[model samples]
Target: MKNQSNMPLYQLFVHPKDLRELKKDIWDDDPVPAVMKVNQKRLDIDIAYRGSHIRDFKKKSYHISFYQPKTFRGAREIHLNAEYKDPSMMRNKLSLDFFSELGTLSPKAEFVFLKVNGKNEGVYLELESVDEFYLAKRKLADGAVFYAVDDDANFSLMSDLERETKTSLEHGYEKKTGTEEDDFYLQDMIFKINTVPKAQFKSEVTKHMDIDKYLRWLAGIVFTSNYDGFVHNYALYRNSETGLFEVIPWDYDATWGRDIHGERMAADYVRIQGFNTLTARILDEPDFRRSYKHLLEETLQSLFTIEYMKPKIMAMYEQIRPFVLMDPYKKNDIERFDREPDVICEYIIKRADYLKSELDLLS
Candidate 1:
């Protein structure tokens, strides 16, 4: 039976910790326990009516919201999160650091090594709580800042209007060319350009005239050889009423090209076809082209000079290589990826040249 009362029981299996001791210390002596002890068994943890049910939460990453029971102490409502089972505790930390460097705001997470249950070699991550933000969907417009995947379109859930727009596009129809500005793409480029007015940029924070900073970032992404950076894997969130927006980038599993070297992994033209589509659809406008071109040049020169991001990229590569590298058992599964190195290298070279062209214009 589906429970529609906004509360549901969730089963959580935790590698046992000092939760038992902690619970006793907080609740046993309290006049009224904040959290009721529901069930605890060896390496098994369960909670009943503990907090609000989290929907759309999945392994690896999730956002949780919780309200305090009337019996609990101090705060009225609180939220917390956990990331568990990482062997090196690399992904969570790297993710947090990457987002921070990119100026994306998110809840802080700390690495926690769990070895309390008489079991060794366990690791977990604890994260600070964040409040839920309502989502509003809008249709992609002409010169609209949008991302299309290499293959699929049904990535983010579409509202009725967006669905209708996509259906209309799939037919012979198209959004009138150059009617609207690709605002988000423009924003991204503006940050990449030199002498661009700070007020013109739409970030909530100060707009730094720092193209070198962005160039290093681009180099990092290229060195990592992430192929899915095109539109479908990235997007923006806007609060319609406030008009404030934030970019949301997702999907990284396609990166690293474990079966192939980074050069070949980055050259795959099939993987990079989205670049042409993006140029045609989003960068087709004269204003966008001019604006982004200026930023592109600045970004290129900066990346060409910086030697640090290369090592950072290499360090990151070494870090995740073991987890993603092709193994003897997985040879049959990964053979195809190994066959095509130029496919990846070609894409990276093209991307580098594109950036260089844009930068050359400035000189």
Candidate 2:
């Protein structure tokens, strides 16, 4: 959870034209080249502003990749998430830590101070890119099919079924395999999830996925109250060995009872079930619903407590307290910076209890 020594303080200097061009065309296909200096080593790197919501008129998040196939700490690229919405910049890292604790693969996160053209750009969360290196780090095969599920992959098979062409099924997913040729692996998965009879649905679905783990992942998302993540902001990876796709969470700056603007949402924000198509279908089965309820109880008992998370939350707060206060680019009220950590602490306590009550009612 602490900063790693291998990823140096990223001192980046980009040409004014390139920077302006990227800002002008925020969704460009090509990455603007920049002279990046990390640990006093200069390299030709391609940089691009990424993210739909975080693309501000002033500051934006970045996707950085090495031009020469070089890697820093075994990562060819890293996502610099400008957590502009989170007053407490530690939310994303803490969310990722919570996911890892819940027994799911999450991107490794670290805090970093970023400087562009000798100007400070506040603190940024440098996250591991979900690329080939990420899978290798997870000890999985190199050729595993990976898809970045965007807002289009809402898990609602109805959305895909209405489309006249198979190309529409690829709406929310961006394939990392670099092959545009449509094999319909994802489409068929969705079709079976939607069309399979209730009698044999679980058996057929489990053949292509770790349903228990997927259920846990869904429950984990709801427990954290990450409404933004139910549809998108995740990595869908087809496990090489099992040949089933597993859910890996991404983009949690809006989770943990916080809205996109970092304000608190209602305590009982998300429904206990039916957030997505696949999730709704799975929960309809009496057995799977029981498993979800059991998992929710187990999580609330095991790790979803103030006692277990307070130390980690406070440690992150202490680490970022100074940098965040000094950040001129940070838009949140300076007074609210340190105060939100305790709010998150409180959210953990309340969410665990609330989920317990809801599960009881559902049962």
Steric clash count of candidate 1: 18
lDDT of 1 by residue, 213-282 (tens): 3233333343334444433333333323333333434333234332112223323332211242323322
Per-candidate Cα lDDT values, in order, are 0.32, 0.76
The list of candidate 2 runs beyond 4 A from truth reads: 1-8, 143-145, 160-167, 178-183
Rate residue 8 of model 1 by lDDT.
17
Model 2: how far residue 348 lies from native, Å: 1.5
- The TM-scores of all predictions, comma-separated, are 0.39, 0.91
lDDT of 2 by residue, 1-363 (tens): 125322236788899999888777777747898977777778778998878867763668899988864887788888898888887877788888888888787889998888889887878899988867889887975444455556568765545334533445567788765333323666677778878988889898887667877886887788788886777778777765677777888888887768888789776888777387788788888888998888888888888888888888888877776676546677356678768878888888888777777886547
Over 4 Å off in model 1, which ranges?
1-225, 231-235, 240-245, 256-264, 267-279, 303-306, 310-363
